[model samples]
Target: MHAIEVCNLKKSYTQGENALDSISFHIPQGAIFGFLGPNGSGKTTTVRILNGILSPTQGSALVYGQKVTANSQEIHRLCGVMTETAASYENLTGWENLDFFGQMHGLSKTEIKNQSEQLLYSLDLYESKDKKVKAYSTGMKKRISLARALLHRPKILFLDEPTSGLDPESAQNVTQMVQKLAIEHGVTVFLCTHQLKYAEDICTLYGFIHKGNMLGFGTFQQLLQEKNSTIYLELRGDSIPPSFTPYQNANKIYKIPITGDTDASQILQGILKQGGQVYEAKQIHWGLEDLYFAYQRGVSHEISTKSNDL
Candidate 1:
C-alpha cells in the first residue's frame, strides 16, 4: 500500500517565487524512503506540508489515502516526527518529556511506563533518565526527542537528521531501531539526512530534490541505472596486476571495473593466486553519495547548457 502520495505539490511564499516546485512521489508502506537534498532545497517545506503543519499553494498530499491539510488532525496522529528543532521541556527530566507526550498521544500510564523504560534503555539513557533535560548534552536531547516521537508506536515516522549529535554507538542504536521499525513492525519512514553513508545502509527507496525540483526518485537499482553508475573493484596492495589502473591520487590502490559482486569475487581469487599481499579488497559501492553528486552534476550541466544557449 502507498503510505504517502504527493502530487503536483507546490509552495510559494512570494508572488513569483517558490519554495517548493511542483514535485510528486509516493512512498510504500513499511519502506524507508530517503528524501535527500541540499539545504533550502524545499525538503523541509515538503515535510511540513505532508505533516499538516503547512498548507500547500497548490495540489495535495495524502497520507494513507486520506488527504492532509493544514487543519488535519488524523494524519498527525499516525505520524512520529523528530526534527532538528523538536522541542522538549527544559525543566522536565528526559523520562518526563516522554511521559508527557505519550499521555498526549492517549497512551495509558502503564503503556507509557513500559515503553519509556524500553526506549530509554535502547537509547542508552536509562542510567540518566532522571537527569533534567537542561543539563543533558545536545545528543541526549536528540535521543529524548526521538523516544518521545516513538512513544505512541506511530505507524509513520518522519526523521530529519536522527543522529545529528549522537555518538557512534548512539547513532548505531538509532539506525538499528529505525530498521526494526520498518522491517519488524511495518512502519513507513521518511528520512531526511545529510549522512549519505548512514542513509545508504537503511534506505529502501530514494528521492533526490534540487532547487525545489525533484530530479530523481526510485529504488536503489533504478537510481543506479539513472546515473549510469558503474561498479569498480578497489584493491589495496603493494603490488597488483598490470590490468588494473591506479586509483586517483591514492597510493597502493588499484581500481578495475567489474560487472557485479560475482565478477569482483572471481577477479579477487585470481589476484590471490598471483600471491601479492592484498591489504584490502572490495567492490566500491556506487552508493548514495555517488548517486547524489551524479544527479546534482547532471542538473548543473543541463542548466549550464541552457544558459549558454540563451
Candidate 2:
C-alpha cells in the first residue's frame, strides 16, 4: 500500500487564486519521496493539508488509505513531522522538550529517555542536551526538534528542509540518517525542499511543482523516460565513419542518441571498426538539476507559444 496518496488535491484561499492546483501523486512505503519546488509553489501548503492542518478545496488526501481529515489523530500517531519552525519551547531544555513530546506520543518514560539520548548523540547535540532551547544555536534547535519527531518511532517522517540550519557536516549527517531510516528501518520519508543537490542524492521518487501546478512526478529512471533525456557522447577521436555521419559535431565530439548502455557499447564498436582512434569518450546524461531547469524552460516556452498563437 502507498504510505501517502493524493487524488486531485487542490487548495485556494481566495476566489480565482488557487494555492494548489489539481496535484496528484503517491509515495510508496519505505520510499524517500521528495517534494521539490521553489518558494510559494505550494510545497508547504501540501504538507499542511496532508498533516490535517488544512482542508483541500477539492479531492482527497490519504495516509495508509485513511482520510487525513477524519483520521488526523491516528495519522499523527503514525507519522512524525519536522517543519522549518521548531515546535519545542524555548524555555525548556533540549532533553526536557524531547521528553515532553515523547510522552505526548504515548511513549513510556524509559523508551522516551532512551530514544532521546540516541537521537541527541546521533545528531551531535548530546553535549548540549541539558541546555535550554533558547540558549542553543539554530542548528542545535533543529536537531532537538528532529529528535523529538523521531522519538515515537513513527513509520512516516515529513521533513521540510531538514538541513536548513545545519553546518555542512551536520547536514550530511542528517541526510545520512534520513537515508538509513528509509532503507534500513523501512520508514517512509516525505521531504519537501529547495535543496536540489541533496534531494538528488537521497530521494527515490520526486515530484516537481510550479505555480501550484504539478509539473511532473516519477522515479529518476521513470522521469528520464518521461523527459526523453538525450544521451550525448563526447570523444576526442579521429575520422568519423559514414555510420557516425549523423552524429558529428565541431571539435572531435559526437552526439549519439542512445537508448541505454548497450547502445553506447555498440556505437563504440562501430567507431572502432571505422578506424577512428578514440582518445577519450565521456557520456553525459541529464541529472535532476538539469531536468528541473529543462522542465521549467519547456513550460515557459510552451506558455509563450500559446500566447503567440492566440
Candidate 3:
C-alpha cells in the first residue's frame, strides 16, 4: 500500500503564482523517499499540502489511502511532521517539549516518559534533557524536534531538512535513525531536502521538483536508468594493452567504460593476458547528486530554449 499519494496536485497562493504545479507520485510503505529540489522549488509547499496545512488549488493528496482533506485529523494522527523551523517553547526543557507534544498526540504520561527517554538517549540529547530549549545548541534543538515528532510513534514521518543545522555526527545519527524507523518499524519517511549527497546515502526512493513542476520521481537505480548512466571500471597497476588504453587516469588509476558484467570480465581477462597486475577494479556508478544535476541542466536548457522561442 502507498504511504502517501498525490494526484495532479497543484497549489497557488495567488491568482497566477503557483507554488506547486500538477505533480503526481506515490510513496510506498516503509520507504524513505527523498523529496529533492532547489530553494523555492515547491518542495515545502507540497509537504504542506500533503499534511493538510494548506489546501491545494486543484487535485488531491491522500495519506494512507484517505483523502487528506476529509481525514485531516486521522492523517495528522498517523504522521509525524518536523519542519525546518523547530517549534517549541523557549522556556521549556527538551524533555518538557517532547512531553507536551506527546500529550497532544494523546500518549499517556507513562508512554510519553518512556518514548522521550528512548529518543533523548538515542539522539544523544539525554545529557541536556533538563536544559531549557533556549539554551540548547542548534543541533540539540533539531534533535529535540525530532524526538517530539517521533514521540507518538507515528507511521509516517514528514521531515523537512531534518539534518539541517546539525553537525556531521548528528546528521549521520539522524539519517541512521530515519533509515532504522523505515526498515525496522515499517514507518514511511518523506524527507524533503536539497542535500543530494546526504539524501543519496539514506533514501530508498526519490522525487525531484523544479519550478513548481515534478521533474522526476523514482528509485535511485530507476533514475540512473532514465539518465542512462554509464558504468566505469577503475583499473590499477598498468601494463595497459593498446586496446586497453584507459580513457581517464588519475593517480595511477585507469578508468574504463564497460557495458555489463560480461564486458568487465572480458576486460579483466585481456588485462591479465597483457601481464597487467589486477590491483583493483571497481565499478563507479552515479549517485543522486549526479542524477539531480543532470536532470536540472536539461530542465534549464529546455526552459531557456522555450524563452528564446517566445
| Model 2 ranges with Cα > 4 A deviation | 241-250, 299-310
RMSD of 2: 6.1
Off by over 4 Å in 1: 233-285, 299-310
Q: Candidate 3: worst 10 consecutive residues by lDDT? A: 301-310
Better of 1 and 3 by TM-score: 3
Question: Candidate 2: lDDT over CA atoms?
Answer: 0.84
- Per-model TM-score, in order, reads 0.83, 0.90, 0.87
Best by TM-score: 2
Q: In candidate 2, what residue range of length 10 has the lowest lDDT sum? A: 301-310
lDDT per residue, candidate 2, 103-213, as tens digits?
888889999989988999999999998899999998888888888888899899999889988999999999999999999999999999888888888999999898899
Candidate 2 clashing pairs, residues 3+ apart or interchain:
none
RMSD of each: 7.1, 6.1, 6.7
Q: Write the per-residue lDDT of candidate 1 for residues 98-178, one digit (tens) a residue.
A: 889988888899999999999999998998899999999989989988998899898899999998789998999899999
Order the candidate numbers by TM-score, best to worst: 2, 3, 1
Could you tell me the C-alpha RMSD of candidate 3 in Å? 6.7
Candidate 2 vs candidate 3: the TM-score winner is 2
